[model samples]
Target chain A: MNANSKTENRALASTVLELDVNNHAGVMSHVVGMFSRRAYNVEGIVCMPVGYEKNGLKSSGETSSEISRIWLLVNEDARLEQMIKQIEKLEDVLSLRRHGAEHEVFERLEEFFH
Target chain B: MAANSISNQKEMFMTSKRSEILTGAQIVVRLLERQGVRLLSGIPGGAILPIYDALSQSTQIHHVLARHEQGAGFIAQGIARASGEVAVCMASSGPGATNLLTAIADAKLDSIPLVAITGQVPKSMIGTDAFQEVDTYGLTIPITKHNFLVGSAEELLEVIPHAFRLAASGRPGPVLVDIPKDVQNQSIEVSDWPAPGASDPAPAPDAVLISRAAAMINGAARPILYLGGGVVHSGASGSAVALAEKAGLPSVMTLMALGAMPVDHPLSLGMLGMHGARCTNLALDECDLLIAVGARFDDRATGKVAAFCSQAKIIHIDIDPSELDKIKTAHVGIAGDVKAVLGQLVPQVEAILRKPWLARVADLKATHPLRMPGIDDPRMPYGLIRAVADCLDDEATISTDVGQHQMWVAQAYPLRRPRQWLTSGGLGTMGFGLPAAIGAALAEPQRTVVCFTGDGSILMNVQEFATAAEEVANVKVVLMNNASLGLVFQQQTMFYGERIFASKFRGMPDFIKVAEGFGWQTLDLDNAGDPSSALRAALSLPGPVLIHASIDRHEQVLPMVAPGAANKDMIGG
Candidate 1:
């Protein structure tokens, strides 16, 4: 396919989600469970604890190792809006930002999987 | 010099209020006391013995030992549903935690506030499959509002109070806190105490959206108020009724929202759903504006979502934002407390008589009202509920197990106040009634609590009868002995080409003997010439009494919208 067609195909096939969540042992289970329970498939996931800055300063004290960022790639469907709303309802999910399929986060990691 | 002296004195005072060493179990009990939990229910086991030991030392809190872990969970649900406060229940590891899952899930679906504390295997043996070990936190992740797996005793100080807060705050649900055996035994020094967790104030309704909703209501010639469980949960029934009356909107309630608007109200259409009155559902079919408050469009409530109120423009108000468009998109969706939204929206809307529309509704009501067959005969299902209801005033709390009896009570019983009626609406749990009724009675000792249960439902939680007898709870269990799962039988007979399977029971236990064996006062209405008087006498002298009455096995909950069918396609009434 041509470059523009390839991008269009990808957009039609999937959407990427960026999530900021609490870094805890059960956090990943909770995020995945929400999908698994609904029978919604999550094709790719990349999660890692990131440097969480609070008020533009490095968070200290007990919350030093608090936040983690998660990237999810999944098929776009009618239920996606409802799924996003549900994910936002989770207590551990700090924030969620939706991105189109053209987002580079998942595309860049495709080479490693290949 | 004076400021320096004052600072020195403050430091001295801080040092004097030093941390005292206490085990995690002691901290849990102390925290529950601080949270103003006077009564809790649980069953002690190997893992939870330490907490029970600590509980025994607590003079402020009283623990009711339930016959089963599920009973304990439902008991807590009962207290929460009755009092609108976050109630607590505890259990040990493995099976105990698993058993409590259903009640927790029930609370979650109904949005009742509950804190469930379960004892976990020691942290070291957690993954080793030690005796009575379970992954409680993982298991409860989907069912609970939030859950905590405490790694350390110090975490208990924060987790306990936080669990209560999470359970009570926005769209309340059950929160589980799993404490490992080691954590419960571990000693920790705790000086500072956290404040008791209470419900956080709901966010304010959007003025623009509220105004839009007001405009829609004002402009529509035909409008209907759709009330849900959220109305009862948020204590917004009064405000909802006010909005309905002021706008002259005929109101229909979901099963959970039955008591929100008085059944006797002139503008009330009673309940609208699967087994709702024909007129109520027909009115929704005809409305131009559907104002849904605090209610998600549950499938049972909204039969065939696409077809439900197809002509109406919906203005949905709920505390949970996700629920707004989850099923059906709303014209104006307001994610705020229903009580608060109505408080503001009521005044902004124009007060109109809508005479022609109301007259149309009245004609529908006159033509297709709820048919209570054998309503005056005490031997029949509807009559039994009415007879039971006649014996007690509005102060009496009515609960029901999931079955034909539950629907009969929902259809016929005069539930005139909010929280006056409690049934397993969302979960449709059969075993919920007995234990929940005991809990409600225990919570509010003055009010007489009655549980209308069918034979099939009462058998699911028959063990709780012993707990009720032991506690001497003012619970009246009116057993409708139909010798079968009535609702299941009805569905099979109607939808499955008249083929009935395992719905009927071949052998039935002598329930009166069973109740008497459990130390309960037994009343057999089967032979009573004056059943009403017998019911009154039994209800008056209540300390866990079982009043058994035989119902026809073939009786069905009518006006049922066949599964996945539109509400307009109701079968019978």
Candidate 2:
């Protein structure tokens, strides 16, 4: 169980960069296609809509004045910083940030119906 | 003047020969009708407007405009599951097709036969990223069992029948047909009709492997039967029960295999999982050998893979070859239809007299009996369910949405026939109960059909209540109204230290008023009286009925094998 702890953390690995597209028109769809076809660097991403009010900003090239946010989780490295730069250029995109490690891999469950 | 007149004649001739002509609306009906599609459920969109216009004029087939495309997909699933026949659904190319994804995925997981036909933008502009021209073929491949793109009018008839067969055959799932606009507008000769029965996938049972499985089961001292959804899909429910009855081995169903055995039967252990009965888990733990039929060891079924029945010699049988030894190792691996294999295994088990094994399994059941906690009161929720089951015959079909009510039905009802229970198994899609039960009722109107759903699940497609009322379908909806998302809140209470985040819905409208609003006679099961009178009254009251039973908020389904715990370690009060 402690094999990884005993071993060194010398191997270079990537982290996920999340984008919150707020169900905005074809932003996330185009983004996913771009990643799959063009970037091919981001791995294991999940995106859904959040509120633009929380971020206190507006998206670019959106036909509607009402702004929306999208949450994306990506797996990368310094590449995350670079991907952020590219995603910012897309219209109808407000702000993108990495949701840091705060999740728990469910260990002990007391419930019967899961 | 003579030259000009000749030139005009030549131009007229060339214009007549320009490509081929097919009316957009006529193309839609011809492709579907020629393939022998008798039933289709969907709301028509602009992209598919022409198709609907054509279908309206044709009285040969029936087209039902579903309240939502999602409901359309589920209804198609119900028809396919009951009849084992392929059902069709039509939707517009873009937003319409996207809405149908959940249902398609549901059909894929449960192995239901469905052919979802979506209209696409014209083929003239192949990939300019044109309007309503989403790559539906590519999007549905991973989710659907199979998919097709019809590029020409000639292949229209060819694709339709092939789609029907491909979806109906072995390990059935949804197939998507993306018909381009240009093809729909072309006229073509149809002298040769493509026969509709060419796509059946029959994975024949291996006779040698069946005998080998028989030998293993015949020799084991203590054997237990584990069943899953494939048993239901493969029509192997009879063989499953026969194997259990012959060997005197206790049978446990996965969530998907609820109807394989009558719940009240002595040999039947209701379900085996986190919410499984204590007796069922104990049976799994104590058995000397485990005979898994048409069941892949899902994580929910096997909480901790390493600790799951480690002492037992496992024998696995499945139609899919890769499933063998994928999750857990098997002592004997047999790939074939479970029914065929079990037909051979029954006689072989008769030869082996494993009295000790039977005694041990019975002992295990005796030691860990799962008695419902609120058994003393007649008004108890479980008692209410038992009353409902008693009123309906064993042959009646039951469909359920995922929740506490779903588990309650599984723990209580006794089933007699095969393909009588349809549900969302692998992907527990909510709002599956009412529409699915409607389809089941339509498939066999004479038999009593009942659907059990929670307030949360029912709200997902509450409009279908009107559909049930509108259509001459007799479906009884038993709404377990705790006025909460019972399953979600139950898990949060047990696991999240009772934080109670986003699962509360207390002060709602009078459920009776709501049901009556939908034109359903509502019955409030307030106390421990016989609900049979209300049920009888509703059965005669024209169409569908809703029985709303109020249950406790904190009630928990027990015998939990915690996430990553062994089957033997299941905890129940």
Candidate 3:
């Protein structure tokens, strides 16, 4: 429970979550609810639409005509593989992969300072 | 598929359910329900009678009638914060939407998931100066995450889901959906709900940069982990602690990153900036490198941006690309979540510790030390706050209103992780503490909320006292009452000419009496040297509890570098 943990003995863990889905009606709540029910910590969730529909019924293809993608930064050691599998099984989810659970983040200070 | 036939079909669908005329309000409710809205918090008003009537008939959805439209917006925000869901609130046109502006800005700054539905004048009457017509969309764009104005119900299904997705996705924020009177009365069957499913988010850090960041950290002897709200949102508290522990780094958190690490951690510096901990400011001034995560360099956080951490080699990790290079200069910045980035860098930093830098920082900590009085110290508020910190969980959600009391909490209390401490950091909104606490409590019902507010701050929205009672939220209210507008008095004393303009509040209301009136268990602490007993009592109480404590009137949040001054130009107590 250390300062990162709820108590004095355990230490809080961190993880990275990659969202893989094709459409908007994807069962996002299912994966989120699973995480919530399991007491998982969420850091940041970012998503963007990449692919447009082949039919081209939509105008500029802004609002996810083809595929929707997202990026999640979550608390780690959260049984990431199991979480990914569960997310992949959700209705609109096309795939799930874990890329950097074993890595660290590096950045530039000058790039951030205007 | 044919254009003319499709237009005709759409026009026919807009007629109504039974081919009868419907009021604007009825159309609004149906469109809202079609968008899968379960509950809406708002008040009844003169211009929105039609919508309320429609809401009354819709059994699938629920409406929470608020005493004021402001409270309604706050309640919706509460739901969003707790559930990570887009909560809806509504008001009539004009004053209704205006009342929601404060909460909208609140949600906008804090990035809460919220949707505000408001009424507008009929299409023909618009700009012709119709009654109850206000340019809500125009007033909202600058503040809202996104906004929409619907003239017809044909745009209902198309706009509703789009609003929710925008509010809930990306860096979540508030969205406004205003439907005019004629639009709500119309009806159209939206054939297909847009099925852009919720996609998985990228949790990976830029592995390529991890070595570079670690090298920078290793190269610098004195480094500070400037944790931001993104750490909490990223759920990277563990990684943060690991990296800090491994690197033997001292850490300071922004208001939003208050709870990213446990308060009791040896290297943990509670909060940074304006009302930040003195020790934290000292650490920032001396540190040569800053590891920032999910933490934007907000003006409030940076004081005067130019002089803030001017010399530090900053490694900023964030997800929003636009936030990069926004305020302060960054030597090394990564656009990603703190959790993933920290995950990548933790192992890399293991081999690269600057022993000299660590030793120098230790030397600094020993040389210019932070003083801590016992929980029973004569600085009554300080002692009580410390005791409360001792009693509560490291992960407990803490909220505060804007005032001297807030500054005190930011200084005294220890936050262990992000998202655990919520406050009006950017806006410095006064009435925000209580309502925000209520909202936080509602959002994460399983967790407890401790709200630190000033005597002046609590009164801004005392109506929420009853809200706490009615909602039965697990909330603990600590009212640091100094019998005056404490912060205002302090500011006037310091900034103003000390002529005492409206700073001295007279005929103060007895807050204990007021708390009891709202069905909250009340405790009066003229000098609560040790707040343990009160905290225990407040926690042990079945429902919500309020503790009113008095503090020094002239207490200024110390260790201050006035705006635009170098961080080294600090005013230490």
Sorted on TM-score, highest at the top, how do the candidates line up? 1, 2, 3
Model 2 CAPRI quality: incorrect
lDDT of 3 by residue, B1-573 (tens): 699999988887765433544454565566567666776688777666667878889998866666667778877876666455678888888999899899898888877778898888776787877777798877776567667777566556556766777776656678888877777766554444444313237546667777789898877777888887667655688899899988878888787777678766877766777656555676787778888887888766777766677678888788765565656556776766666778778887855455675666567567655544444652466776786777777657788888877876776777655566777666677787777777677667777888888878888878878777887868888887777788778767777778678877788887888889988887776645455665666665666898777777866666665666655566664
What is every candidate's C-alpha DockQ against the true complex, given to 2 decimals?
0.49, 0.02, 0.02
DockQ, computed on Cα atoms, for candidate 1 = 0.49
Instruction: Tell me which of candidates 1 and 3 scores higher on DockQ.
Output: 1
What are the TM-scores, per candidate, against the unseen true structure?
0.96, 0.78, 0.74
Measured over all alpha carbons after superposition, the RMSD of each candidate to the real structure, in angstroms, is 2.7, 13.1, 15.2
**Considering summed lDDT, which 10 consecutive residues are worst modelled in model 1 chain B?**
B150-159
Considering every candidate listed, which one attains the maximal lDDT? 1
Please identify model 1 stretches exceeding 4 Å from their true place: A1-12, A54-64, B1-16
User: CA lDDT of B11 in candidate 2?
Assistant: 89
Instruction: Give me the runs in candidate 3 sitting further than 4 Å from their true place.
Output: A1-114, B1-40, B46-62, B196-211, B352-354, B372-374, B377-379, B527-535
lDDT by residue for model 3 over A59-111, one digit each (tens)?
A: 22234456666666676553555566446544346666555534332112225
In terms of lDDT, model 2 sits at: 0.72
